[model samples]
Target chain A: AQRVTQPEKLLSVFKGAPVELKCNYSYSGSPELFWYVQYSRQRLQLLLRHISRESIKGFTADLNKGETSFHLKKPFAQEEDSAMYYCASFDNNDMRFGAGTRLTVKP
Target chain B: GAGVSQSPSNKVTEKGKDVELRCDPISGHTALYWYRQRLGQGLEFLIYFQGNSAPDKSGLPSDRFSAERTGESVSTLTIQRTQQEDSAVYLCASSFPPGPQQFFGPGTRLTVL
Candidate 1:
């Protein structure tokens, strides 16, 4: 079975601190990984995708096939960066989402 | 252009009642999707619609749940005999054909009493 796991329910960090939100997945075939963020009073939006190899809002995630992980990272955390983040994998016509991690950046 | 939109931002329904949730995908988007998010949980896929092709309803949890799309534009999810477990936020999303990126709507918060 395909599954996505986000071990942390909440992660808190101070401004200027580095942040990492862990995500892991189990799948048999090639996986398409994505990071989605939802800000307060805003709709859920795509943060980044592994295929594009692009960073959004100073956040980047690298898919590590060895450990089956796609952890999102930011060198410097900001208050504006605080939001609920979800990791997802697209399998054929189905998409599996992790439980999600809520990040809080305090000043 | 406007993003995907879902109707009834909030709905309070009695248990055993029927309710309908609507979604309007972005214009020209060929793929539409429905998902459920219970409090403190991640989004759960419920169904998918692509163009005029038959919809993939495999994610639907039970026969009480059904959805239909018209001409690749508007879609509606109907739930019969709502249960307390049915209380959740129903989200709608759309993406361009063959595109991996999906845009989500604000979602409808359904409360079953």
Candidate 2:
């Protein structure tokens, strides 16, 4: 089974506009969810994890078990926020990632 | 003090040739993992190593791909009889045991012709 799912391949939002990146997982157990970001020519780094429940760079994600979704949302997008975002789930000592969403926040 | 580092940042090999990629995890991190990402694709879990425990090799795609970690430190992923489809960026990440927060390397871009 595909452990993680990201429906959108690319998302574009204007500065100051709201943006949401959808992510869903198929792991049956309480797998840890994480959001990772990679800027151009940079190594992939952890943006935030569901376990922390803390917002980083104005981005927050809620784990909705009923829907099995952990959608990342930000009220106002910034150009610096533009990068590649990947949703990942860790289970059974393995981390599975989605196809990723290339977020472009235009000015 | 150094982050995860992968050697041979980029490699280009001919088809059917074997290639070895190396990774050096952070000190004191007993957990090491190898992953890869093809162009326009997501991260693909390749293998996981923790402490002295047996590695979880189930994620390996085939017998052609294998990895080894010595004394819970550096690791190397070897691919035998590489094919064009094997062209991708191989990434390495490491963290403390049972920690979900992994520090990733810059990744090695392998191009098989």
Candidate 2 TM-score over all chains jointly: 0.97
Model 2 chain A TM-score equals: 0.97
The TM-score values for the models, in the order shown, are: 0.98, 0.97
DockQ each candidate and list the results.
Answer: 0.75, 0.80
Docking class of 2: high
Model 1: per-residue lDDT, tens digit, A49-81?
999999888999999999999999999999999
Off by over 4 Å in 2: none
What lDDT tens digits, residue by residue, belong to model 1 across residues B32-53?
9999999989999999999988
Instruction: Pull out the clashing pairs in model 2.
Output: none
lDDT of 2 by residue, A1-107 (tens): 54899999999999999999999999778999999999999999999999999999999999999999999999999999999999999876768899999999999
i-RMS for every candidate (Å) is 1.3, 1.1
Per-residue lDDT tens digits for candidate 2, residues B1-113, read 57999989999999999999999999999999999899999999899999999999978998999999999789999999999999999999999865668999999999999
Q: Pick the candidate with the highest DockQ.
A: 2
